[model samples]
Target: MKNISKIFMFLLIIAIPQIAFAESSKIGVVDLQKVLNESAKGKEAVKLLEVEFEKKKKELDIKENDIKKLEEEISKRGSLWSEKVKQEKEEDYDKKVKDYRRLQTDLKDEFQRKNKNFTDKILSDIIELVRTVGDEEKFSLIMEKQNAIFTSSTIDITDKVIKLYNGKEKGEK
Candidate 1:
């Protein structure tokens, strides 16, 4: 009976700390996607990116149309032209096509680079904010929504974080 009591005491001692830790643990969840999509700065950043890319997109469209027209002309008029003229036209068409493709690739690469930079900057700001929130609120663990298997709405701090982020952006501007 004395040995049983000692074993019981040891188990109780181990379990008590775990129970206390579970009770004290404060977890928070943030949906970064939600914050990025819903925040004012995020929305504005998207609009800016779109506007910045729109001009290049229009230019690409025009270039594509020009290429198509040239292709049509080559097909329709090549038979009527002398060999030299036909060959020259075909060469010009090929060169233009190559130029168009290169420009398209350059534009795509630039857009992706800009987008990643913007996303990184914004997400960096958000993570800083999350850290601040976690510290201030005494959260034991704060996790990204995507990383979690499931989270209760009560533990979700996304809206709160978004509000804070928007306010910070407003203050900055």
Candidate 2:
């Protein structure tokens, strides 16, 4: 009977660890890039940026046309004009060209700034939504999808994040 009791105790010790390992931690992942691309708020922000881009492009186009016309005028009539007059026209054209280039640079910088601001805001909103989902679902860990090389499809919560982001956007409006 003592031998039987010792055998049962050994079996119980082995099974105890197995039972502890049976309960798994709930982990979730979110694809932030996909959320930014697929979400409605992201799309709207893109559209607004595009509109601003087109507007700047048109202004640049008009300035470019003006430059081309000035160059053509100099080519056609520069030889007949006084040296002083030709020099002045050349200076004017140079200044205009410089201004156009500067404006182009400024527009690009502005666009980048605006894009960063938009992304920062959106990313924060996503983080908030992720936290909410994690809390509600009782997830033990929520990781960025890009960080994981191998995750089950069941653990991917990017779609859930996008859905929540869009819903939150709607509520704000």
Candidate 3:
């Protein structure tokens, strides 16, 4: 009877670990890039950035047109004027050209900075939402799809996340 009890104890110990291992872990994959591109907030951010870009582009276009006009005026009248007057006009043209170039560079830099900041902010918000979704769905682990070597479509949660993010942005909850 002692031997039977000992055998039973040994079998239970072996089976306990097997039973624990049999439970599946709930893991999910989220594609952040998809979230950024498909989410409504993300699309709104892109539109805002594009509008700002077009506004800045118009400013640069005006500066460029002014430069072209000055260049043409210099070419048409430079030969008819006295040396001093011609020299002054030439200097003015050079200054305008330099100013236009500087303005162009500055506007480009500003646009790029704004774009980077907007992208970063959106990505940060999405990551926070991903965490919240993971918690609510009882995920044991959530990984970025880009970082994973392979993940099945059944475990991909990007669409669900996007839906939740959009709903959140619209004040649905």
Task: Give the number of the best model, judged by TM-score.
Answer: 1
Clashes of each: 0, 0, 0
Task: Quote each prediction's TM-score.
Answer: 0.94, 0.80, 0.73
The candidate scoring highest on lDDT is 1
What lDDT does model 1 reach? 0.95
Compute the lDDT of residue 87 as modeled in candidate 2: 100
**lDDT (tens digit, per residue) of candidate 2 on 1-173:** 99999999999999988777656568899999999989998898889999989989899999999999999999999999999999999999999999999999999999999998998888888999999999999898999999999999999999988988999999999
Global lDDT of each candidate? 0.95, 0.92, 0.88
Superior by TM-score: candidate 1 or candidate 2: 1
- Per-residue C-alpha lDDT of model 3 across residues 1-173, encoded as one tens digit per residue: 99999999999999998787656568899998889889998888889988878987897888789888888887998788999998998898889889888988888788789878988998898889888987888888999999999999999999999998898889954
RMSD of 2: 4.8
List clashing residue pairs in candidate 3. none
lDDT for 42 in candidate 1 is 87
